[model samples]
Target: MASTDMRDGLKCSICLSTSTDPVMLRCGHNFCRVCIDRVLDTQDESGVYSCPDCREQFQERPALMRNLALRKIMENFRHTKPHQKVIFCTYCVDSPVPAVRSCLHCEASLCEKHLRAHSKSPEHVLSDPSTSMEKRKCSVHKKILEYYCTEDAACICVSCSLAGEHQGHRVEMLDKVSEKKKEKLRNIFQKLTTKREKTKEKVRSLEERWRKAQETAAKEAERVTALCTDIRRRVDDLEKKVLSEISRQEKEESQSLSALIHQLEIKKDELSRKMRQIEELCNMTDPLTVLQEPDTGDLCDPEEEEGDKDTRGHVKPLHDGDDLDVAVISETLSTLCDVITGIRRGIYVAGSSEILMDVNTAANNVHVADNLKTAIWTRKNENRPETTKRFMCNQVMSRRGFTSGRHYWDVEGSRSGEWMVGMCYSRIDKRGRQSYIGYNHKSWSLWRYNNQYSVIHDSEVIQLPDKISSDRVRIHLDYEAGQLSFYELCDPIRHLHTFTSTFTEPLYAAIYVYESCATIFEDWLCNWP
Candidate 1:
């Protein structure tokens, strides 16, 4: 029987075989020269090499130093005897016999005959022949771990239960504790398997939604292409508008599905890891180790209330109806007709008005560009010379006002913050909330807060079903017809909301900017082909 130290010394760390052509590193670790050369080659790209044994890194691949003395010793040892390890009975002094079991209490290996005659005590913990016996004994009490302390969730020996740190705790026999833990582990494993399966199902559902959305988007694209071809040269700009809208809707839906699928996959991976850990614990042979292992925390508990709430509340499963169905075929046809009629009838306006921002009516924080077409919320007060016409709030108006003729102007606004665009009386209040477009009887405007869209007049708001897809809005007013209309410049220009009332005074192009900006386009609907 070879000694443990001699056997370990001869084994190479890399290949775990007896060292051949042994070489020593600067870190004082030895390995076969061929093994070291191969390992060093892998690190060449990093410009540094690390010792496999000590993990000590070197700036460059160190030259291999031959250990001639160690190599000579290895050769002699190999020639004298083939180094194979075997455990024998400690009591067999004259005739050595192979050991079948090792006693932890006695710290000795026993042959079959001796094992049969050995004292059957709790302390004499017998296991398959092993060199390390101290592991079976308690580190604190130096006794066999026979009891499991439930309070501490640790293994305790006889003395540990009676007098040590675990004294007076709820204790159970090791076998009983291990059996209970295994049952729990099995239950946890089953739950994890169920969760993983559910996560897989969620992934499949989202993937299916994604596939359907793509198909719907493709069909929409084809229909739009066919429509554009039919319309030909008369509506070239309309084709680009329709295609862009389709792309935007498809992107939003696909991104949502992708995010949900990613989250489900991550949850599935976590469940798999937990299941593997529980399975390993259930199959463990040592009762003490199984009982002494730390709790798996929330990983083992599948029914956590907070986790369930978060999953249900935040990670909502996308409904089958969440596909990219922006507009049905009939709706698209109707919208196309509206577009053609609006183009031929010239309902927007006969000619474009050179609309510009009124610097005098602008709020202190509102910055009107030099071109007089843009108004931005500067946050800090500009301390503009106070005047009776100046607005107290973040509001601005166009330099021109309308009293009779049909007129329209296109204005672009930020999507993030709050903004309002509409027609208001030139004499609208300049002081309080009444000065805000859409808050009083003198003004009517389409208001946008984030993605929501609505029209407000005389403090009465009516939410619009059409979402804010385009930042550009066309405000059309026919002073003689008593009609004020707002249209979103998307696809086939969608009419948002319209207000009809007799005009009592001259109306001005007005806007309210709260951490937002608005810009009037130089070329308007009158320029469209």
Candidate 2:
């Protein structure tokens, strides 16, 4: 019975009174089970609980040991300790425990009865500790960060959104912004890959074309070199043959002159000896006496007279001998000159001389042919209709056309806005009349013209309706197909009208248009030229 009373008399460390539903804390101290549990829960920080009495920490909520025997004994003797009501709080024990001790104001242990008495008093007010602590937290009041603006797909924060700078900007969560950027990066990567492949193909194609061009240039160079070489060889051979013929002719003339001089010298010598003998015979003094003496007289008399005549003839013509020799030498020199002149003529006639070639003329002809081919290729490959359509869509706000000295105008806005304009001429026909026509959007008029200076006609102005904005107008000319079309701005840029004709002399027919502003007719018309 005494042991039972002693067990019942054991006090709670928290209440400082006889155990009431007592619990053993991790420190082995006894307290009311609910009281210790509340203290343990309130004191927990970082998920660790500490004993109130010994301040010993526990890793987790320790197992609660209920003393059933002590509990039953205390139940039986509940009224025995009624006078010992002054209980100390285990957490704060300088004075008696408050009626409703709370952890809100201070870290103090609480008794069930303490809080009720404390609330009745004006000094203390019952407040939710959890709510008051949460109110003081900075994280709850802080605004979340917005990292992306969805309008332009930009990155920004919450402060930027509230500032009027991003009034209409759509914002996205920061976490999602990274994903969006990553997706964009992936798309860019794909585009880069595609571009890389395209560039590689282009490079390879260019390399192949370069190789082919190199081969062509090499072959052409070789051919040109061979032609030049062959020509030079022929010229050299001709020159050599000409020189040889001249030399051979000169040698033959020299040999013939020497032979003629030798023959003339021998004949002159023979005539000289005969004249001497005749002179000797004619000089005899006793010719008359001898004529009567013998047969020799008759012969001597006739010979003497003939010899005197022959001597006179031989001595008579010594004046013209040098002149005859000079004539023969001049004839030989003239023949040599004629042979040299003929050789020179033949050399020039061969056409192998460098001076005959006009390199600049040949190069110019080649250049002209290349230019024509390039022009033809450009005209064929370019889409004239599509280009014209694009031009129409992008026309200036004001323009004009002239016909018969009369100016027509197409205008959009007052002189305040921007403008653009274009004009083009097509090829002409044999009739000398202007067969090609071009339309201007600003004046809503068409002007027909020739490739030369003549302007055929300008159509009457077709005013644009207010509902149809000039910015939305598009014109297309298909000279090859002999078709003209106008389109309104829509999904497909709706065709307003189309004109088809069989006449196709014009290589290209074009139109001009306007959009935002109007100007003087002079300003617009001056643009055509």
Candidate 3:
């Protein structure tokens, strides 16, 4: 036991093993001769050297001369167990084996056989057997790190704290500082987990809204498809009725013309037979008999003259009933019109009021409904007496016009082959073609000519893409804001165009139906009182 203690006391502080060529400084600190020499050489570049242990300053240099006595003492303990600090290799690619010694400089455990092939320089820094010696020394100061600089958050050695860059820095024990940093990292991890959960919750909410939107769109599509089907069926039935009435008139006219044709054919046959008899008589060689044959005119019966006189340019006119037998037609149209209103009211219950046609403002070619909400364009003039407010052109305005507040209404649009519907000033031209919506500056509107579309303002046309018209068109007018927006009212409304301008006059909902009806519904009128 005493021998072990004595040998351990003789170990070099630099390598923590039996020292080779041991030396003592003026401060009485001991190190291997090579170790002290290297340390002093680094400090000499700055014209300063100090004892590694006590940090005592040197003015010029330190002697590198070996201590024979200390060396002899270390030699005595070299073969003892206290000198058993050599490391064996931990093979990274092959089997594990003992290391000859750990290199403090490289921080790698070397194999026993590798020691002979290694560099012969003392700077290679062989130490006590250890694979975990990497953290034992401060990298920059090249000394055992004895403290942690809390302010700088770094591990530092005694040399660094006393004479190096961290000389005046606040420091603490390494273990205590590590614990505080670990707690901080744990708190950060917990917060990140909470944030992840919040993101997942938001995703779930968004998914639910998306699903509901899809469902609503599907239901609206189904409703519209069914309504259109019924509409087409009723229209087909009406077409058949009108055709059937025309067919009955055609049959009656055909019979009357046939009787006139038969009477003329009989008259032609009688005239042909009598003329042939007269020719035979004149061909007789007996001239006396030919001259005395009671005059070929006397051979003609008096009744024949009467028959020829009566038959000249004779034609009986056929009766073509001008009036259609519309018993079922009138009832069918009434029912269909009622169904249209029902569909409108059921489809829209918010955001707009039902609109109606204005009779006083309707043109001669328009038939305004008594309900005043529908107008069908007749190809011929209705010939009603002209009123002061009646339009002379193919256009009409609503009874109500907006000077303030927001207004929205939908028109049951016509596939009318040609039509234009939009907002116009109440005082817009009502006398000529210029009085038509979009034909003047007072109107801001979309026009559908055939299947194509365009926007018109100040009589200038902006061509738009062609699209099959939607079943309905919604007009959104912000009176105070001076905005006129049009949308194709589908399952979900799609904006087609917008007009932004300052209004100078009250704007009316003006419509033009060229060859069919365009209906607008007000909510109050559509609803039951």
Residue 406 in model 1: lDDT: 73
**Model 3 segments more than 4 A misplaced:** 1-136, 144-146, 239-245, 263-529
Better of 1 and 2 by TM-score: 1
> Scored by Cα lDDT, where does model 1 land?
0.82
lDDT tens per residue, model 3, 89-191: 8543476667767776677777867666778675576766785787678878777666798778788987888898888999887768778888998899899
Model 1 error, position 527 (Å): 8.2
lDDT tens per residue, model 1, 53-99: 89998887898999999988887776776544689898888999989
Alpha-carbon deviation at 449 in model 2, angstroms: 14
Q: In terms of lDDT, which candidate is stronger, 1 or 2?
A: 1
C-alpha root-mean-square deviation, candidate 2: 35.7
lDDT of 2 by residue, 1-529 (tens): 6755675458776776777777676567767888888887786666878887788888887767887777776787765654423434434456555333344334334567554444354323234323232222223223233456778665554566766466567787767878877999999999999999999999998897689668757965895686667566665666666566667666776677678778768956866776675666567778875355434333343234444355455433212333234444445445555554554433222111111111111111111122211100011222232322222132211111111111122222222223222223222111111222333211222321121111112332333232333343333343333344454434544445444444323222122212222222112212111
Greater lDDT among 1 and 3 belongs to 1
Tell me the TM-score of each prediction against the true structure: 0.35, 0.27, 0.35
Comparing 2 and 3 on lDDT, the stronger one: 3
Where does candidate 1 stray beyond 4 Å?
1-353, 525-529
Superposed model 2: Cα runs more than 4 Å off: 1-170, 275-529
Candidate 2 global lDDT:
0.43
lDDT against the true structure, each candidate: 0.82, 0.43, 0.74
